[model samples]
Target: MHPLPQLESYAIRTFEIDCNQQLTIPALVRLMQETAMQQVLELNISVWDLEQYSLAWVLIRKRIEIERLPMLGEKISIHSYPTGADRVFTYRDFRVYDEAGQQIATAATTWLLMNLQTRQMSRIPAELLARFSGYFPPVEMALPYALDSLPPMEQAFTSRNYVVGWYDLDFLKHLNNVHFVKWMLEALPEETLAKQQIRRMDLLFLAEGNLHDRIDAQFQQIDEATYLHQLVRQEDKKVLATGRTIWV
Candidate 1:
């Protein structure tokens, strides 16, 4: 395979920033997602490549840590690579840097191979594992690749309702993961969004949300700087995803 930790640079654009002129979480996710797609495509192991095997990648959980959010007009570089794989999951990591080359953010993500027909998790194919082996350095994140459950709502401090739009669905016909982050943030108090910067976030995607589903996004403050969030489908109250975020 090509050299590890492929790099891609982007100039933060007008549309990618929030009203405060800082890069938004969803935009950051899109940048990282594009960088990842480029890396897998270069390795001939992209979702299209796996489609021939009746499989596709599904992201299960992710954790992001930010030293600072890049501002509008800033140039940032994302360095990403596959970290390793186990029976059930393949791991990936990303480091984001600014024009001055200072690290601003890091993310660790867990992905599973899904059987296209059954929509069930699948074991990593030996050949596929072999393709990634030795190309990446030893894994740096902790093992078991799990996220902690968000504390029970106990009465959400704030809530908002949204109907999934056609544009929110991904190739799987399910809501794209980044929108979950967007909805969660939307449910937060306006004061928090205006005054604080996110220092870290952890998300666990529990279920798929289809188009036009009514979603209730709820947020609860656990402490001064930490908060818990949940997205539930209004029809059956099925939790589509949960998240925890810490702000500075």
Candidate 2:
């Protein structure tokens, strides 16, 4: 079997940080993309050489758990690899650590290849899967997480609404997870925003709503305890996604 690929490294870009002085979720997602690309390169089948192929990797669903987000000035080391493949999804794993090697977060995201022109998922090419299977690494204590549905929608919280926009889509052409967090965070009262420091958070994506899709964002909490937020499609009342944040 091939050895696990070397960990990928990147410096935090200023534009990737939010006003909170920490790496935003969207930026973290980019880092995941960067490392995964490196993993693809190790197999000698990266997209850079895909002029002959009409298919592309697409992000389907992701479940991330962050212990503490990296500060603006800190650098992070991300170790990632394709863990395994299911019927239609190839699972990729990630381990993020600070400069001191203290693990900050662990996550797993699933991806599927899509025909660029057809825009539909394609089967996992056997050769491609075989090459990646050998590079699987040892599972860490908190390996890539398997996301579960939000415990309950509990309407006990305050809620606000916002519409989706074109800019929110990623390479997969749907609402990126970070954009969901942004809209939900915005629902917090200005006073709660004054001294907020998120210790950890989780995002659970459900149905994919389109541009101009009005979403109802709800939240309720006070005095530094964990806060819960949920995003739902306003018209159908369908839950779009859910998020949780622990702050001080």
lDDT per model vs. reference: 0.87, 0.72
What is the alpha-carbon lDDT of model 2 when measured against the actual structure?
Answer: 0.72
TM-score of 2: 0.74
Please, what is the TM-score per model?
0.93, 0.74
Q: List the residue pairs that clash in candidate 2.
A: none
- The residue-by-residue lDDT of candidate 1 on 134-166, one tens digit each, is 676754442334446556667675479999999
Model 2 spans with C-alpha error above 4 angstroms: 41-61, 111-125, 140-144, 156-158, 190-196, 220-224
Worst 10 residues of 2 by lDDT: 141-150
lDDT tens digits by residue: candidate 2, 1-248: 75575597777778998777888766787787778777788786575544356777765556666788898779899988777776677777788999999989877676777666776778877776776777665555225546455455455465676788888776456676667767777787766655665555666666666778888888856346667778888888888877776666
Q: Which residue pairs in candidate 1 have backbone atoms (N, alpha carbon, C) closer than 3 angstroms, thus clashing?
A: none
